[model samples]
Target chain A: MKNIIQNKSKDLQNEIDNYLKCITDSSLLFFEGAREAYRGDYDDAENRYRDISELERRADEHLKAIQYKLYAYNIAPDSRADIFELLDGLDDIVDRAKKNIFQICVEKPVIPDCMKDDFIAITAASVDAVDILIQGVRSFFEDVNSLEGYIKNVYLYEKKADALEEKIKRSIFQSTVVEELARKFQLRYYVEKIAMLSDLAENLAKKMLMYKIKRII
Target chain B: MILKLFYLSSGLFMGWSLGANDAANIFGTAVGTKMVRFTTAAIISGVFILLGALLSGAGTTGTLGALGAIKALPGAFIVSLTAALTIMSMTKAGLPVSTSQAIVGSILGWNFFAGATTDYTVLYRIAGAWLFTPILAALFSVGLYFLFKAILENIKIHLFSLDWIIKLSLILAGAFGAYSLGMNNIANVVGVFMSVSPFVDIQVGDYFVLSSLQQLLFFGGASIAIGVITYSKNVMMTIGSGIYRLSPVTALIVVLSSSLVLFLFASENLQAGLIALGLPAIPLVPVSQSQGVVGAISGIGIAKGGGNINTRLLGKIVVGWLLTPLCAGILSYISLFIMQNVFLQKVFI
Candidate 1:
């Protein structure tokens, strides 16, 4: 029974790592699609976003599977709580991405407008943050030494995303045209999604750190 | 004492209705400005109100009994319940009216039913209080706007830094308003019943303390808190977007000023304070919550070059203020008469 519990814990960690990796890849691809839309490569952008959305859906499915496994194993209440929050956060990011893509496909506002560059920068920074989040969680889960640097780096990236978003909002308000207004509103939504995604990643990293302290991970 | 039980139960219902309907007055601007999300605003408002009621809401619990014309505990209970039912029905019909006036009107109806013992002087004072609450709210809004403008000019700080500071201030102000609502208005919603009946005796070591009134205020507040969180989104949305444009500073100032007015008037000696301040003897009843908010908004409007005030909306709200009590009194009186003649006389009596 002890050996089985240990093995199940190891499997849970592996599943988490794979989920973060997939999220990072799709996030980068999503940003690339956003950049393409700015460059007037509408077809390429649409295709890339569609691809990212499909991957995000699969990632969510895997996350749900892991949650089911954890429940089946009668995971400690705290560990179960952490998993639920992490999965929910992960799913929220993907859902935001999917929604943004839908808005792009349907609304099709003029590309590379006032908010375009800021949106790209925020998403790129968010992707970087989520990448470090995976590393931080992995280190903490494995009881690897020197996890502070990874955690601090994730905080720094999230802060950077926040600053970028602020600057973008200020610029959007400065412009007065109707088209600029539409672009600004859309850009704000996407930037907020990226920031929120990073925030969730940070929460997961914190939970991992706590789990390590409790020796539950 | 037995009659007081019905009064207490009715007051609890009134409190629930008050929380459900009037919370929007405190939270609408913040939610409308997108300063805070509606869900966060509601939850925070709910939790804080529970805290406020449990702690500081005692002052306003017996406000109507002290402020209005209801003759006895049974009369007060009937008045409160009738007013509450009228307000709820009106709310369902999409007219956002005042719970304060409803309670006052229902008490007046009860007085009329029992004959001329209702204090006309107190009723007049209460009417005057309604008239003044909005005016004071507007004055405070205007005053705060001027004060803010002078400070901004004198400070000579970076605009970006100022924006961040103002946003933070708005958040804090919204939270404070939530707390104050819990402390002050939560009583308006549930306090009547607290004074009406008795609760189970609670044992403290060797001594047993008996409550003369039901402790249903807590439950009523909870119910209203739930209603506000669940159904108040639409009202907040309507007010937030449709009302006048407000800068972050202006919004914060208006809320702060209005909340202060509510807090001050909601004091234990609010009646005496009004007299001391040489304000007309406003009956200490729950006046119109919407009126106070409108007055504050208008104050901000006057401060921000006067174009921001939507006169049409203000007029409509005033109409609601006028109609709510009269309708409650007439409807409740008729309903009570029917119940007395056809229902209660045949059943309980």
Candidate 2:
């Protein structure tokens, strides 16, 4: 409420917005890499992963700046830790995006023609989950009452991503038509990693809710 | 003229402390929120306070004069100095202090020393004002909040424009609050000096002239301006964020309500009107601006939801409020005794 406190929050909010933009870009880049991998374009997938790594590094820089500012600024007790916790959790979403995309580029596993759509679908769902999460995070600072609705949408997309992961993993293991056992396991791992990104987003939403409670109550 | 000015020093000091401390209530939120610069607030407040002191500071001094008279020059000096010292000490200790109560206590001490009978009815009325001023101000704020909230909801104003409006409104209300503060509480600063004023009517070019009381108010106003320029920021920060987080709208309401209470109590015509209409007169009492602001803020907190307030800090302030008069009274009494015996000064007429 105080002007001095709000002035401090302005720089902090700017830092958060920068980090969040990078996270959003990384999520979209992760989805693009998954599509290239499904098309048997390893070179394109590698380029996208490199792009995601750059975004991740930029997001990390912003996160560091924010942490430093929080240390420097004599912020309000209600907002200081709660906002940092929210930023930390959001930053991890970018980390997961980077890690998931890198795994796809490195493994270069064989994908069945039939399973390609499902892989792309899982990637789409994961990115959607993070986008909804971005909106939920924005709502935390703006309209707190609207955050629950965005989080519910995040959970819905997460569940869809999980169901697809389970279905695809089971088919890869069961069919005798699949040749290498090691390759089969790797396929499951890659699919599971994509699903993990959504899970991380879901986790962030819940942790954000926790921090919001700690702040107001 | 020099002796008259020297005698006015104590009142000037009390005025300085009042500006340093009470300016927080009027402009703290605006300054702390960074919505207004401290210099901007100080300038607006100082000019308006000077205007209000010149125009409206006389009436309240009449009631204070009735209480103990403090008719001798030495007694007035000692009483005002004791009140000023009490405020400074409490402020340094990081406790909320009231200029009004300290002045009353010092006057009471002087009353005892000068062998004047205390006017019990005037004292009771002042005591009554202290009891009800904050409560009444809080009610005014609560009612104003809901009414303003409803009116604001209907206007689909842009956020930027709304921010500008609120900023302008806060400055305007702060200026109004400054005027009301000068009008009501200036008496607390210089009321005792009125009794022993040395200047008679003076004429310069037959058109421009000044009374002794006018000189006192002018000197008092200048001291408060100096306090605002030099010392208000720390107190403003404390009251702005320390009490609770006040929004722009909430800050405006709190200030308006505080001014409302001061104005209501300060107006004799309004009091007489109420009495004529079969209603009890609201006692004309000098109130602490901080107390009124705190009460309004807490009132809004209750109106919204009730659980987040810091009860311990509030408890300390409550204790300080209760002890303010007692401390000032004892300090004044002892100081007056020492001035009479140790300094071998004439303290009473």
By DockQ, the best candidate is: 2
Tens digits of per-residue lDDT, candidate 2, A106-150, equal 777778988888988988998999999998887776666567899
TM-score of chain A of 2: 0.92
Candidate 1's C-alpha lDDT?
A: 0.65
Indicate the TM-score of model 2: 0.77
Q: lDDT per prediction?
A: 0.65, 0.79
**Candidate 2 lDDT over residue span B1-349, tens digit each:** 6866777778888888788878888999888876677888898888887777777777677778888877667778888898888888887886767788899998888888777899999998887787667677778888887877676655554322345567778888988999888878888888887878766767778698888788777777778777777889997877667655577788889999988888877767788899999998777677777777766776676666656444565575577667777788888898889988997777777
DockQ value of candidate 2: 0.08
- Candidate DockQ values, in order, are 0.02, 0.08
Compute the DockQ of candidate 1: 0.02
TM-score of chain B of each: 0.81, 0.93
Off by over 4 Å in 1: A1-217, B1-13, B67-77, B89-96, B156-164, B186-188, B191-195, B198-201, B205-214, B269-284, B345-349
**What lDDT score is found at residue B137 in candidate 2?**
79
